[model samples]
Target: SLGLEKMPFFTDSTMAKVMLLLINTWLGAPYFMVLISGALTNIDGAMYEAAEIDGASRWQQFKEITLPILLLQTSPVLILTFAFNFNNFSAVYLLTGGGPINSEYRYAGSTDILITWVYKLTKEQSQYNIASVISIILFIFIASISSWNFIKSKSFKEDSE
Candidate 1:
């Protein structure tokens, strides 16, 4: 082993939250970057030209042409990512194990999101009934979000004429 000591990332409450945030961001950012860049490239150059001909300013062009297209193109992935990260067990579990315990919350740590807290309830605390109820509620909530996203998403709407 190298002489350099390993920093205790999980020892402090705020630091653990920061570390978890950093980890999740670092792990997930590149995929979104690649997808967004791909979406950017797919935008037609003629749209900007048309907007320019219509006397629209660059900001107007972006607002009118770019933002809507990008939002439509990436809305599905964005929604899915939100749902996935809502219960991202691995990111918090593998990195900090939901550590830096807080005295305020019983059976939960500072970085413990709801999913990890449920996990702790079931696995560590042996409180199966509460964990089951929580899991059911979480499933219903996530399902509702996903259903709403699909229903309201312009990208997913089928045109029937």
Candidate 2:
């Protein structure tokens, strides 16, 4: 069925590309969830057994052993997931076109992310310079957040070890 909400905000080619990215991300998360579940299964059962022997409750066992191990195994998966969600475009575009409209904002629809907005401006509006500027800003934001996550993961490893 062709719901109005299902339409992309811009029929213009520029916005179409952003919509595709959103779609890809929504599809990608299930794969990540599979990997995460597999990682959880790989955690050693022996540790839990030992914790139980020591009178640690199930919650304590999970908190002390399961979570740490899970975190260690899933850190990279988490990084990938974060990156995916950060740039996720398809889910947004397929559903809303990123707008029902907000004119007060310089270049945004209700659903526009920095990345999608840039795509629209460059492709639809022919505003290459502004698109590039927005792209740079997004790159910086993603890089900084990823770097922080990596650092924190490293610290977590150190403390746990």
Candidate 3:
């Protein structure tokens, strides 16, 4: 006995994206918090005191000191997190199953990411060649992003200097 009640947040594609993002953030926030907490431990309280003595506002101190130090300390973790999320096959597969299918698309559903699309190509359709190509492209994309992030990290720069 189905009712005509509206639940757009669950049914709508746009809302589904928001829901997935919220879920992802909820899942990832703990790890991010831990990394940031460790970085915060490394920052000297004297630095904040000195900044306050110089008449720096809270926002200014955060922007000039805390943000940079956190970013520097957590850059590697950030990069790894990016890579992990980029290819998060299990989350996509188990939670949504690349669902809310769009009839227009050949194999991919509305929520189907690259990994899921590749899975469909390989498993359902048995198109190994195309799946391999897609996998290669995905690998290249992830690798390039990771490489750029690594190069831009403070540790890399510090080592070079």
Candidate 4:
């Protein structure tokens, strides 16, 4: 609610996109924070003590020791977060409902992600066949990404070895 009455109209797709991202991040941060805090607790204190003995500065300790352990331990959660965001429909649907339509794109609004677009096609337009096709495509895309993430996860690799 900036003084829009005083300022010139600045309607842009980028502003809506940025706002959506910020809102989604705000909604998602708490979950990731919990995961990261658990991972942090599990990190070995001996590692930090060794780093301190080696005259490492606080930044150096964080960079060389803390960051790597957190990343390695939480990589799976990161992948899960990516997957969740990829298919996230409720946030976009509830907040914007795929609004501020772009005239150029057929049946698609500027803020519509793939899932919301599919929902619109099915519910509003009665395009069941097209919606089904789009649903299959979305499923394939998510599955591929999830499989790739599992393959790349440290736990999966460790189990294989």
Candidate 5:
């Protein structure tokens, strides 16, 4: 009845990915916003006042005071969000059903990310070993990225200090 399936938004190979991206962004933006807003609240009002007294413009205040602090506070969360979203299965599976199948790739759809591909590989094709390998590789890849980001983030350094 929703007619989502028949819609070109979900049926075209390219458009389906745009729909998936929009859906994923719509789902995730709130959580990131909450964290970021919390970080903004935590920033010392004294800092802004000090900047204002020194004749720093709002743009200058943001560039010097707000942006760096927010980046420091939220970098870890951002990295982890990336890792989580990188493996997001429900976003693709529920929205697209991994449909608008790609003619080029075997057993894969245009909107299908690694995790959804694993689901299809294991559940439908019974390609257990291939799925397992992909899962392990994905784990390693995401872990490495998150670990690197955390190691480089000011939060991690400050926490260690």
Candidate 6:
């Protein structure tokens, strides 16, 4: 049923995926907003004045001055966001119980992420070793992507000194 407005929407898998995506995005965006606001607040007012003297429009100032500085300062926060979202399982588990009804899959629900599926395997099916293996794989994948993004953001190369 998945309890969408006190009605069952889980009968259709497409609706379920859409709902889950919305919920996950809702949970994630606030952290990004708070972080970006803080970074924006810390920028020196002189930079904006200089850009204005050079006849830069608002968009040009943001593109040339603001975003580059914010990206440089907030790289680690972005990395943390990706890492946290990589293993997020509770949102899917709580919403759907990982299923629509009686359907057969090997320890996976339609919405089951790697972390949630591993939890179900070890806790419900007692496949401890295999769950551990899957967890390690998930960790490696997230770590590699996060590291790459972190390094790429370091190329912002603003003169903070």
Best by TM-score: 1
1-161 per-residue lDDT for model 3 (tens digits): 38786756545667666767888989988988888888899999999999999999999999999999888888888899889887888877776777777787779877778989999999999989999998999899999999988987876565543
Using lDDT as the yardstick, the better of models 1 and 5 is: 1
TM-score of every model versus the real structure = 0.90, 0.73, 0.87, 0.82, 0.88, 0.81
Task: Report model 6's TM-score to 2 decimal places.
Answer: 0.81
C-alpha RMSD values across all candidates: 2.5, 5.7, 2.7, 3.3, 3.0, 3.8
Task: List the pairs of residues colliding in candidate 3.
Answer: none
Model 4 vs. true fold: TM: 0.82
- Residue-by-residue lDDT tens digits, candidate 1, 34-151: 9999999999999899889989999999898999999999999989998998899988888777888888987888888889999999999999998899899999999999989977
Q: Model 4 misses residue 33 by how many Å?
A: 1.9
Flag regions of model 5 displaced more than 4 Å: 1-6, 159-161
Error of 4 at 83 (Å): 1.4
Q: Tell me the lDDT of candidate 1.
A: 0.90
The candidate with the higher lDDT, 2 or 5, is 5
Task: Give the alpha-carbon lDDT of every model.
Answer: 0.90, 0.73, 0.85, 0.81, 0.88, 0.81
Looking at candidate 1, the ten consecutive residues that score lowest on lDDT are 6-15
RMSD of 6: 3.8
Error of 5 at 134 (Å): 1.4
lDDT of 2 at 143: 88
Q: How do all the candidates rank in terms of TM-score, highest first?
A: 1, 5, 3, 4, 6, 2
Count clashing pairs, candidate 5.
0
Model 2 TM-score?
Answer: 0.73
After superposition, the stretches of candidate 2 with alpha carbons farther than 4 Å from their true spots are 1-29, 155-161
Task: Tell me the deviation in Å of residue 20 in model 2.
Answer: 13
Query: Model 4: residues >4 Å from true position, as ranges?
Result: 1-12, 55-60, 156-161
The list of candidate 1 runs beyond 4 A from truth reads 1-8, 159-161
